[model samples]
Target chain A: MSEDITLSLDDAQALSLDVLQHNGFSRAHAEAITRSVMAAQRDECHSHGLYRLIGCVHTALNGGIDTQTEPEIVDKAPSVVIADARQGCSLLAFEKGSALLVEKAKRTGIAALGITHCFHFSALWPEVEALSSQGVVAIAMTPTHAFVAPAGGQRPLLGTNPIAFSWPRPDGTPYTFDFATSEVARGEIELHRRAGKTIPDHWAMDANGEPTTDPTAALAGAMRTFGGYKGSALSTMIELLAGPLIGEVLGHETQAAGPESTAKPFHGELIIALSPHVFLGQDCDHHLQHAETLFEQILGQGARLPSQRRYEARQRSLCDGVTIPQALYEEIRRLGSR
Target chain B: MSEDITLSLDDAQALSLDVLQHNGFSRAHAEAITRSVMAAQRDECHSHGLYRLIGCVHTALNGGIDTQTEPEIVDKAPSVVIADARQGCSLLAFEKGSALLVEKAKRTGIAALGITHCFHFSALWPEVEALSSQGVVAIAMTPTHAFVAPAGGQRPLLGTNPIAFSWPRPDGTPYTFDFATSEVARGEIELHRRAGKTIPDHWAMDANGEPTTDPTAALAGAMRTFGGYKGSALSTMIELLAGPLIGEVLGHETQAAGPESTAKPFHGELIIALSPHVFLGQDCDHHLQHAETLFEQILGQGARLPSQRRYEARQRSLCDGVTIPQALYEEIRRLGSR
Candidate 1:
């Protein structure tokens, strides 16, 4: 087993940036991608952090990602934005369209961004948080490769599609959370199997549609949706909204949609910004304050709001730094040095 | 035991219209409400059908609803509309604003309606179905009297809030579904309890935060969010979006938010319309065709879409007519006679 080694934020970010730049990314692309990796690391989302650096590098080298292309954004209407990522980074598209989106929402109360030809490979919270900071209530969703089965079916037809939502808070960080429509992550089931622990009943199902407590049996089957049919509907909605609405590669933006082929990631993303400034007018402040009241009530009842732990993790990481597997660090170091 | 009596669609609609009118509703209000109740009955959603008419009449008589007032609609911006239901019927507000909402979405690609001082009851699907029929994608949500607790809390903080979403289809009926974020409906628990069967462990929590299988104990406690923290977040987002964004009754419009009063429903609702005709442009037909492809894939997986059963139920009801309790028919007959 590899031991975890601590790295300061600056060193970790610089190392990832160096590795991307060495892989042929321009300075701008390297920097933008590095920032996202660091944010996820700071929040201790190591799966989306430095651990995925090599995969991004591999994709960049294999033409799955355009190393130097910039996103093209067109303001089609007062409240509509059409963004082409040029088969490049989703962050680049978000970077170009976010400002225009914020401006449009502020002017017209709400705006939508249809992002196509993108490759999104990180947590969606950062983009939503960015919009919230601009006093914009935001929602973001993307369709990925399928890992979840729709409810009542044995076949995996829907992606473990995740959605991120944020509401602006004038006093502090935005209340934000991202969650999959699935009952449990694929990694969670694997962990239980490795540990010889019985899985929960609703977590997964065997091939015959019967719930199983054995983690290994569950793995051989399919993951169940979190609330059965309702969660399945939400997942299907995300696929529909993110895929066809943005004009991506059909409704399921994955290689597994038809006969499988070795293909680069082709995903679509959607971002909606609703501005309280233009929409709520004089009542915006009042609404924000009332939101705080609701938060207090939830806290009083011993319920923590979503994203509280993430924010706390980020704060602690700022003081103590990020930790990653020693072998992974060595691999990144060798790539950066090359 | 009450016998089930079958009522033709025309007779059922006329009976409802007569009762509402005799109770003080104007012709327009009576017509709008009768149309909705009949649709729900036709769809075999008996819980939201004639079952809830008595409560509607009770509220109207107690001054909780304004029988004489018409909905007030103000088009505030190119993509924004503010609607005041004026303590009147929700169907009337929907009737007035849906056309305007459709028009605005077609013009701006996306439009939003913030409806205040409304008394929304029954299903939200009809309004969304109306928008979809106009070739617009729609989402609508409203917070009501609190029934479900936040993820970790013992006290209820959110309504069994429902969200409805629909996508337009050129081929047939638009896909639509509305669902509460709660893990299990109260009626589901009651049935299991009456049957002396143990409830699902994740369905509800006892007053002390322990998961319980006893339905009666769970009823004494609080219902769980569908997917734990994620479902809680969706519920909270709905409350924030529907409550304060509409500026209804000084924010957080439900009665449980403050000292209990005999006030009317006082709910705030949010309706958003997105037009594919404007946003998708040349790819509109292509997107719809691709959507059909995705649907075929899911259906081929032996997974039924969310509303398939509801549509099938409607078709059956149209052929066989609606079945209701004999007592309910007598009550409506007496009210109509008065």
Candidate 2:
């Protein structure tokens, strides 16, 4: 069994920062990326926590990421902010443009931020949670390298295409959900492959368009979207909104451009923020509180609210710190040292 | 089997307008409602076609819709347009607000339209299609009466909320899709029940929360969201964005206010528009054409695109007209005479 070691969230972030900087990321990039990594660890989202450092270092080493480029902000219009990540990490781009997005949404009721030319590896929740914490409802989406097939299709022509949403609450954590449009996350299949386990039906297909339980064959073939055609439709919508609408490469284009050795996919992201104060004018507080009833009803019926688990984990991690696999910790420490 | 009759798209719209006017809708409301019904018929989407007139008449007779009230528009913010339907039908409110949404999006890159105090029965594709046709990407969503259970909950606490999206295609009809967030639409189960057939599992649960294949039991109990927790999260998002964010009623609240006889659900609708020209400046044309490659890839792989069927049906309906059951035609004519 792999041993585990404990670390404070702050320590986790510092370690991430050290690794990122050692991998040649600029200060701003390292700081922004560390924030998201720390957030994932704090919420015990293992896939995005310190475990992701290996992929980050690999991407940087393989030239999939530009560690020196700074994001360039463009105030496109009254309610649109565009960030040209200049082929750097998406974290800094989102960080720089989000303030303008919030300002515009506050002034105009809704605003959009488009981040282009970036390598994205983090979950979208942190971006939306940041916006929602500032009292605006937030939506974020991005297209990764094409790895999923469209509904009724044979080949992989769509990305996992993650989408996230955050709704502000009057108190406590905001309601949030971040999910890939694929039936399962691409990482889940990788995990299964590593364990030499069979995947469930409807998760993927073999290259010949045949259903397969073999994780290796599924990865070599195509992932399937959840809910069939409806999920496929959403994945396509993300491809349009975050891809062509922002003048960025689509999923297939990103896939075609990559070396395929590094797991990183360079693409664009779209974030939209809507302000309740701007939408409702004087009734903001009352309306925001009224939304609590719906949440209460969900909890009262034993149905879990999205992000409730994450928030609970966050509370614990804050009070008692977090644990990581000892071997993984050593691996990250070695990367930082390099 | 029922006998069928064919009618041109113009005749269909005229018939819808006549029936709506005879049923007490104002001229603007009648026109707007007729437009949606006509489009549905033209696209061979039978559910939203002339068959919807029955529900409209039923709701109007049951005092669920206020036909005399004109939609009141408010320029709520720089990129926000609010249309108060004053307890009237939603179609007119959306029609009134969409132009402003397009205008704002053209000016500011992104914009939102909120239609409140209305009873919505139409599919959201029409609203999004309208915006997409005006050269922008569009999204539309609304919460209906609570008929769906949250994931893990036995009670129906969320609406079978519908979301729609449209992406501009430059030449032909834009890519469009609108679907209920439920595993299967409520009407699908109702049709199964009326036909004395069993529904598929995963569509709903019995009152005890046990999965069931009985449509009647499901209807009397709770419908499930599509894609499990992911779809549930989306339905909840629609509830929040269209409900409290707009100072409108949530799904359960709408259900609590209504008499059980009418199928109409009074609520709010949200529409968001994003303009590519505003986002990409002078590169709009090149980027839009670039998106065609992605579409080609999907088509090339023999994977069907969203709304391809609708567009094909539209072509046929425009050339060869559309068919409806003679029984339905007679029923609508009878309502018009009334």
Candidate 3:
């Protein structure tokens, strides 16, 4: 069913926060997580937004994620920090890590944070955009359970392994780009499966390394790399950075039926924060100014900043209300009524 | 064509270096560039190997690339360095930059170097492999002249923007992954053009944003991203980091009519050098040990390390020498004879 009702940005966030609190999240943590999820929806990334609430609640109930624990900074240096998420909700952990990096970068001109043992953090753009809004360039990547295959192989050997980067522009519009390295995200595949639709053949391969268009067969198999060998290599690189290099288990060891399984996904996150002034020096301000002029000159009025479209959609959602599908809304209300 | 040559690796390196020296490169620079180029060829990356020498030499002669200029460290801190290549050959600049990053990382646990004003540096894998061999994790990215278009756009507004990473294993094999964000490299299109063959339709788009298999049309139009939006977004992120973030002109501004043109491509490079022990601490050695073992286990004897194939090819070339196509060999001889 199509949308029958809508919720304003504030109302949606408040409702989400209340739901989390009712389900055992602290008020502060609930607010943080709810805000992040709502922002994703407001920005039109519905796949990672309110749609994930049920899964998140299930995870929390099953002890796969913690809602109350806060991230603790265990080690700090001029340009690096080690954060123990302490099994906290990823929203809280990521926010803490981002803040730590921003502070360290203010002094060192660049900073990095190593985060571990955090739950799924939703989409990466919001956090990176937050950093970029403060005139900092941010790069982030994380590892998860295996869902994608290595190049030329049919076995699922890696997660989607998304990476994101955000940069501040002179016009106050941050350029943000975020995506999973897989040809398509696992969420997309799941959605297709739910919709009873066949996926594109190139998106995945069956157990025997044959391309398949049937969602059932694809799910039983493994997702292929985005661009064959290159994508496979990039996925491996992501694993190295967000896995063993960060003192976490690699993806191959983390693949199991669910997070409740004995196998820890051993998820890891790495964030790099950079200040343009650090390297630009005397040319710092001039560079930004010239960049704006050059960007405008080349793009003219037809071009928009990378994330500007999403941000515009978010603004609209805030000004007006966000529409919720009737089915999803009814489902949420039913749970709340119960 | 493959049977005529049988020189050892040393002889190949020496011969290449002598040719470079005779063509005006300084002795040290010649040896360094020659080794970098031949190493790729020996490793079986003919695209970036000696195949590139003719174009590089042409650029140097036409003043499009500097043959004798030295790259200088313009800015340096405990964990960062900004290098000005002064229009030097990228191989020379990249080597110096990698060395400096390694030196700084030894002290700071991690280091980054920003490079600007350099020519194409051949294959990125070689650079990362060099750093990884020294027990460092390396992330390198660079922007080239515009070739690929943004997703949903027809115009070529960004470079292929290759990103590379390398991680060391205790077994002396390094995992290296290097690739462009474009579905296929411009060089591949160039190869097709030279061979009078039709390009793959998925690889590029014509002016109207429709896919095409014509090499000439693809060259005049834009290359598609490796996998639709994901690759496009990644390329954009790279341009932000390696191009504008580093205070260089964006790809569109660097467009020109080849080596004879007075205009210079605004190539930019960023390298992140990391020490695994920094974050992993006491568990570092064990983690790496287990990682290597698990990697071998997963791949079994059938699979090889990411860089092993290339390294083995180089070893073979060293023992059996390299075979060059007669036409290409004659062209090299003609250039040298000039």
Each prediction's total of clashing residue pairs, residues at least 3 apart in sequence or on different chains, is: 0, 0, 0
Cα lDDT tens digits for candidate 3, A1-338: 36566788877776787677778888767877887889888987888777767766766776666678878875555577777777766677777677768776665566778788777658888888888888788988886677788775667877888888887887766768887888888878888989999899999988776899987888888888787777777777777777777787677666432555754434678788888877677787777775565345325525455576788888888788787787887665554423
- Two-chain DockQ for each candidate model: 0.68, 0.89, 0.41
**Model 2, stretches more than 4 Å misplaced?**
A256-264, B256-264
iRMSD per model?
1.5, 0.7, 3.1
Lowest summed lDDT across 10 adjacent residues in model 1 chain B is found at: B250-259
Q: What is the interface RMSD of candidate 2, in Å?
A: 0.7
Q: Which candidate model has the greater lDDT, 2 or 3?
A: 2
lDDT (Cα, tens digit) per residue for candidate 2, span A50-121:
898888778878888888898999998999999999988899999999999999999999999999999899
lDDT of 2: 0.90
Question: How should the candidates be ordered by lDDT, best one leading?
Answer: 2, 1, 3
Worst 10 residues of 2 chain B by lDDT: B255-264
Per-residue lDDT of candidate 1, residues B101-195 (tens digit): 88888988888988878887868898899899999899999887766789879876787778999988779878898988788666789899999
TM-score of chain A of 1: 0.91
Q: State the lDDT at A202 in candidate 2.
A: 85
| Candidate 1 CAPRI classification by DockQ | medium
- Model 2: TM-score for chain B: 0.97
- CAPRI class of candidate 3: acceptable
Which residues of candidate 1, in runs, are more than 4 Å off? Answer: A189-201, A205-221, A250-253, A256-261, B187-201, B206-220, B249-253, B256-261
